[model samples]
Target: MAASMWRKMRTYVSRKNIHRLIFDPQCAIFSMFLLLIAEVAVNILVIKKIKYTEIDWKAYMQEVEGVVNGTYDYTKLRGDTGPLVYPAGFVYVYMALYYVTSYGHHIRLGQYVFALLYILSLVILFDIYRKTKRVPPYSFIFMCCASYRIHSIYVLRLFNDPVAMFFMYVAINFFLRDRWSIGCLMYSFGVSIKMNLLLFSPAILMLLMVRFGTLKTLLHLIVCAVPQIVLAVPFLLENPVGYVVRAFNFGRQFFYVWTVNWRLIPEEIFLNKYFQTALLILHVTFLILFFVFKWRRLYPGVGFGILMKESPTALSPNQILLPLFTSNLIGMSFSRSLHYQFYVWYFHTLHYLLWSTTQPPIVKILVLGVIELCWNTYPSTVLSSSLLHVCHAVLLYGLWYSPDYTPNDKNLTATKVD
Candidate 1:
């Protein structure tokens, strides 16, 4: 059995095979072609004709108009929507779009531009996975193809979510290389676009904590947080109460009846302030425990050495990052109510986490089926909502406990491509 295992390992990482893969341009071009085709087809067939006319788009367009005319007032832009819920940095996207459409109020044209940006977002995502070289090419391609929720977030809704996501992933790619300051700056900018990017804050915090001292980590976090503060200053100056209400409106009641997280629970229970408080407390506690466990391998050699004696201090940081990314995103999914559009925030990363596991094919399929069913349903049903959270919990549990790759185990990563 030992000999057979050694033989399989050798075959998986043979130097000769790695060299051949490095020069495979045909494979790279084929992958890019397929990705482009998928993006174009989805935009043309599904998104263009969808009659939903996302209410959110109307609100965003109003803000865009206000900005372009030099009369931008977040407090009064979308009267029906209460106020602009996002930071002022997003005004720039609409400003550019407004110019592109020749101020003809061409919202559909803006959607097309957003669709292109979304495609670029996926390209950056693929590049990140390629740099990590852990996910299989076929699996990465499959996840990219299956991202209908992400597609809707982009072309169908013409959301600010994708713009934030594009920034977040670009930051992740930088952070993966230990470029802490630049990554945090990008993350900060993403947060400025839409605060939903804060869902991944714990992951960034964990990564920073693992590599640097507390003082440096704190400094970096402050640097990261500065952009959002600066962006909000003008809005706050004009209408302090409005800015406060809109920017940090977590306690606001859900206006929509159809939601992913709260759909399974009774409506009263879902809306209860106490229930929300309990979830927040539990989420914070779970995150603290997660952070501690992640630092176990780096614990002091003075007194705790015996406890983590078997843990490898020399292991690559990606092992820690994968869990940080998985746990926080799953935490976000369950710790708060998820609207129909929120799925895009973590779907791609969640798929990567799912496939990273050694779960059986049947199990992965069933889990994916449950997730897809939940998101694909327009008005999410009770069963789909319940299963969605259940599936998230399962993925979080599996990723939390999954074995980390050792020096030998990491040899199983995808081969380099030239």
Candidate 2:
């Protein structure tokens, strides 16, 4: 019976189109499993062979150490790099790490732990791709094995960026599964770890409003806010003003020396308040346009007022994924400054976003290659920064014109390589 079943399966697969095979959901799953196994070995090899570069790990330990040693005042908590600027969840998470890794001295164990996180993040991301079936199987290789910077960010640098993103991706996965309440909770947890996760907020808000209507969306908003309130209670008790000011400071100035995305602009202009204001305007403008023209096209003639009172509608998986990722990408494009460690913010979403665009296959591949090169360039030269912007423009254009897939659209499930 087993042999017969295997033969039948082989025959069925053989009859399918070769291109379909490459884009086959089953093939994608198989490739993901293989990559996960290979990634485990690769992470181990990276930890063993490469010297773990200490950029923010020690500072993270110090910040959390203060909380563990009974310091809850956000103003008083200091690390080697600077004061604790991240939210309360970061404190709790790293405090656990501090204890487990021998008061934060066990560096090797920490690397191994982060390696586990990287794998877990990939698992969540793979599940998202599997559900959407937008990108082909080969793209998984580039996502997992092609980028040295991603590996370094996860294991070598031990930046809190990956930790926050791990939760963010979890939230995204849950959103794809239509578990909005849990997704909001997980998203708030990610925000608690680091503020960068908030970059996905505009998109999340749009999704919630569409899926649950206005009143229920407020309940979901409360679900998101409660975790943040619960997490910050300790710090809030010590100094409510300080906790609010430091942990979620939106006006904090970024150091020009470490910026990865704005090398083409002069330092004076980069530091100018007007420059940031302009970027903020551009960001808002792009988001509004996307929401009105692109995302809302899924529900034609459904205005904001209508959507507010309308019955809850089940969204296509890609509908849930695309806007959130595109929103982040737009934010990144207009960001004040992007440090090297910030790559993890949108790295995992690149493949999905690229495949969602209407650009030619070669254009998509070139854009991906240029982006990888741009991020990998240390201190980011003028040419690299310019090239990065060009790539971003190309992608934004492609996404703008790309076909919108409705919930009942047959094309939503059609997997195409080109």
Candidate 3:
């Protein structure tokens, strides 16, 4: 029996099979299963050992309490933290949580619910990687295990960032599967929860124009807009201007103390209007370069006029995901500030973007590790902020030089959804 066991182990550990397990997309299902099991165990351990940090849970409950008690005016809601700035979707989602957890008294149960959310988000993300086949199976290990910050954001802190991101990924999945209408709807739902999802609007707009003609694209835009209007109806009826200004406050400045990305900058400069304007300019510039040059390589020599005509050519999974992910990255890279909780906004996409780059494998791994290090640093220092910027620069640089995507479909008839 000992000899038989040894032989079986040897067969499983053979070099070729191990290679296939890590390098092959076919192994993603098996890899995801094992990772998820480990994640469940980790969550259980975290809950059992780590004390849940109360950051915004109480504040969330208080804000929603106002809504529950018959307040619809966006500017009228207030909690311990500040005025209720999130949209009506946030109110609805957390209101459900409020009732489920015995009026926000049940913290552990909330953590468990978020743990489940974390798992579901991973499943959708894994599906994305499997469909794209852009990253190797081993990259999943880093995505699942490398970041303590991500786990805490979802479970311990109970920030609404993860909740908003959940819908965003769902929308991406739908878009990749060629269901544009449903995808737009889901994307709108995400935006109603928070505005960060709007970062993908530029890419999604380009995609809509390319896939459906200008007229059809406008219909899809309406699909995305209708949800926001419907969700905000009550608040809008009470105070339409307040709902627009408070819920979708684009000029809202973040506190310097909470900033994870701009700690190197002085607080005064960080608060200066010029700094914010500069960041916005840089963000728009980088996006223009990426959209016009790198992303358009899939349809070389095709002008915007022709693209608006809706060619029947199908986009590959990589073609669909690359632009969208890159758009978000550019937005995050130039963001005026990124709080610790904001890590979830771009964490899952880092692995895909890293592998999408032309950097050496070792360089890719090191960049990811440095980024993880930067995020893990509490009350981030000048050194950490600098390191984070360096890593982002490396990723952007690599993506630019990376090989152009090779479409799965050679013919223009269809992009593969399967």
Per-candidate clashes come to: 1, 0, 1
Candidate 3 local lDDT, 118-159, one digit each (tens): 999998998888887668788888999767888899889988
lDDT by residue for model 1 (129-244), tens: 66545554444454666767766777777777778888988888776666778989998888878878777787666556545546567789898978877876767677778776
| Per-residue alpha-carbon lDDT of candidate 2 for residues 43-111, written as tens digits (9 for 90 to 100) | 999999999887888998999888888999999999999999999999989988899899989999999
Q: Of the pair 1 and 2, which is ahead by TM-score?
A: 2
Residue pairs clashing, model 1:
22-418
Candidate 3 — which pairs collide? 314-415
TM-score of each: 0.81, 0.93, 0.94
Candidate 2: how many backbone clashes?
0
- Against the hidden true structure, what lDDT does model 1 obtain? 0.67
Candidate 3: worst-modelled 10 consecutive residues by lDDT:
405-414
Ranking by lDDT: 3, 2, 1
